[model samples]
Target: MKHVLAIGAALVLAAGVANAEEECLEVGSPVGAFYVADVTGPSAGTKLCYRCKFKDRPVVSIFAREVNDQVAGLVKQVDGVVGQNQDQKMAAFVVLLTDEPESAEGQLKTVAEKHGIQNTPLTTFDGVAGPASYKLPKDADVTVMMWVDGQLKVNESLKFGELSDSKVSAVLGDTEKILN
Candidate 1:
């Protein structure tokens, strides 16, 4: 029974490792520019490349398939962080990846207003796959990438139902890695 339990534990651990390794954009990788239609923020209704705008600044980019309560809460928290770190030129944006960009824009706008998300722009990509360069995993419901000087410092991928409060806090904490 003990040997059997050990094998089961090893399998579970291996599965977790595999999932972690599947995250989009490895650390230290260069982040390229990608355009998304800005639903809310300074450039509302315009398609723009946030990467180009925030060049060399510490940035947190979130790509999510759907907007849920958890995602809204995460965005709100990230917005607050961005507001507090303006002196550091820390920036962040949320990209909603959907097949229907038009409807996604409305949903993003609603989330921004409801959550008072002033610092983070809520944007939408054309499809659920996200930008071709991103190579976002099909199983990933949300992918958060933080970079400084255009080099990625942190990359986290969470599947549906995986974005808990603790996970949000962990992601926020990792922002320090790029802020320097």
Candidate 2:
């Protein structure tokens, strides 16, 4: 009985330590911030930052090469759900990964407009390094990271051409639980 109790206590301590080590962006990771035209906000430009902004609200950040119809739909649904839950403080952002971000803005804007996901903040980041900084797989085309109170809550990835309806719903459900 004594040995069993000791082992249980050790396991509990290890779990606590593991959770403590898991932060949204580890110290020294690139800030990965950029300014972009607002699709919904009244402001002309909004500076989206992984480190500075969304301090208090739970942030669902989608890192993708393009905001396709499926991705936009998922974000729209999650945004609506979060909007309905007044008790939950949350924000959604799409970080487009591209080599030529300036040129890609028009395309991203069009995609957002087409899918009616204008409410979500959309911008572009330089390379895979941005997503990798958050520990996403190098080959991942889209990675969703949800953070609450500066802690890492969810880090999910979907390969290029792999964003299915079921996967999107699962991710949103996970985010909902975290916000709750």
Candidate 3:
């Protein structure tokens, strides 16, 4: 009886892990248009659709619930990548999901300036749940979706406390998938 119970528990745990690893946006899905308030981008102080603006270009879109050090680090690295890939028209943006978009705007600006983030735009979506179409999981603290020529190539979701240094490196490496 004990052995059976242990096996059942292990199977349950493995199933949970598998579900978490599943991509939020299935690979190869068409990237859709969604408008966010551009806080620190070329179109600052306006609501715009980055997906529309960067159509058919390689893009790295990050949605984060909060701007912590790890999230900031990821954005900074992505900013560098965008700058390097300008010739390829690679673009990236960070969308902060919050109920209080007014308050989040200031913090987004600070993070951009502090990190000297010049290439990627830091924008805000006016809800914690994010765009209805994206279907961002409530438990996901950070979700990264990359696309090339309007088709998603990578979708990675990281829960709170899961965005470690190695994970950031792995995410940056995924940029190559889209860039190519």
Candidate 4:
């Protein structure tokens, strides 16, 4: 009876450990690739793969279908985070996932100018596949994703008017922890 009880307890402990291991994998699944024009860069019209652009630094990506106050605030918030952490190798990308990406270019440029976003890049992709590659939902107004050292560290989906400073800070803090 003692032997059977010990074996049963060990099996339960092993199961717990296995579940914990799988939890990490579930969050860090690989993202697909897509290309976009870097509207804010010196070579403004040049196109590049979204993933390859920020593979080296910790990336904060905000995927929004439309630019609302929430999206603007979140982008500015993340731009500040990246600014403060410039020495730590950080980057932010605002990905506008719209049907008519070209038409939104002027508006995105205006938003970037308004926010004085120096650290983050403001841009848009061609199709829905861009956000889909990041595993973002269609209805979600903003999805904030962070990747550090080529690993997807944080993936947060926020609705309009839902982002707060504390939440953005926590994500930045968590990614910083990964670096250390």
Candidate 5:
């Protein structure tokens, strides 16, 4: 009876901790945040957020679908490094923001022609805080984000501090709202 009681107590405690973590938007793995976006499908591999800690461990993977071949290819590449919890099994398209509004608009139209995605712009006017918007297929699974550097980027700025120009790579600052 005592053992059973102890097990029950442990389970309760575990559940509480899990709940707390789920609600703790800021506290999550190095990969994209679990509670950030409405991620669906297979799962993304290990992703690295800017504010992630060294000891962070991945817990979930978000795999969006409906993107073009380019988007799917990017997702597969990124997920490959996410290790165990990677949601690579998932597939999808992702809208990508451009380095600049004009270029983004153009690319959206071009990519759409080949991939059949409709481009949409996020038109950022926050003045050095947000990125100008570009549109892609609404169902794209690739993680479309912005690069404050304008028009083009050498790398995807997953971490906030990496923004050299007053650019934002995506709709989110961190994993905080990506899962929404």
Candidate 6:
């Protein structure tokens, strides 16, 4: 009976370890990719704080706080892509601001109207709420898109592969144990 109980306990622990690993694989990081796991204060201001491993390269990260000041920051980020390659926009910006989801969606639509970002070659879905998803670009397999989930009331993306929820919660969670 003692041996049987020990075996059962071992199996349970093994299952738990497997689940924990699965939790991180949902979104799928690239080979040799790793996230910063933690950082100091947010970068700019909009809650973008993340440091993700991106396969064989030094870990890559984005600072959300920097986004609170959107106009200059967005321009710089998108333009940074252009500057780096000087051809196509290197990254796509998915702006998620506003204290409320409705307001955030409204702003996206408004910006699309005024700035003509609607349904263009690059610009896909407008600001709809909840369960929002997008496909990975062929080249953007290396990049990540960040947005707000007003329903779950968190920030997440399809980019992080398996780490999406936890990573997002780290950004939005009220818990003390977060990277930054």
Which candidate comes out best when scored by lDDT?
A: 3
Give per-model TM-scores. Answer: 0.87, 0.70, 0.87, 0.76, 0.22, 0.29
The sequence of per-residue lDDT tens digits that candidate 6 reaches over residues 66-158 is 122333233233333433432321222333321343334444445434444321111112222211232222222122332221111112333
Alpha carbon lDDT at 48, candidate 4: 79
- Model 3 Cα lDDT, one tens digit per residue, 31-114: 889999999999999999999999999999999999988899999999999999999999999999999999988899999999
The weakest ten consecutive residues by lDDT in model 4 span 20-29
Q: Which is better, 1 or 5, measured by lDDT?
A: 1
Clashing residue pairs in candidate 4 are: none
Per-model root-mean-square deviation over C-alphas: 4.7, 8.2, 3.4, 7.1, 17.8, 14.8
lDDT order of candidates, top first: 3, 1, 4, 2, 6, 5
Residues 20-139 of candidate 5: C-alpha lDDT, one tens digit per residue:
545322322222211111122222222222112211221112122223453433334333332322342211123233324333434334543443322111121112222112222233
Q: After superposition, how far is residue 160 of candidate 1 from its true place, in Å?
A: 2.6
Pairs that collide, model 1? none
Return whichever of 2 and 3 wins on TM-score. Answer: 3
Clashes of 6: 18
Model 4 deviation from native, Cα RMSD in Å: 7.1
Q: Tell me the lDDT of candidate 4.
A: 0.73
> Compared with the true structure, what per-residue lDDT tens digits does model 4 show for residues 26-97?
347665567787788554788877578667577777778788766787788778888888788787788888
Assess candidate 2 and give its TM-score to the true structure: 0.70
Candidate 2 ranges beyond 4 A from true positions: 1-46
Candidate-wise lDDT, in order? 0.91, 0.66, 0.92, 0.73, 0.29, 0.30
lDDT of 2 by residue, 1-180 (tens): 999999999999999888756634553333343444343333325544534666757777787766677777777786676666546657777777777766767776777667666446677766645644465455677888776666667777778577888888888887754576
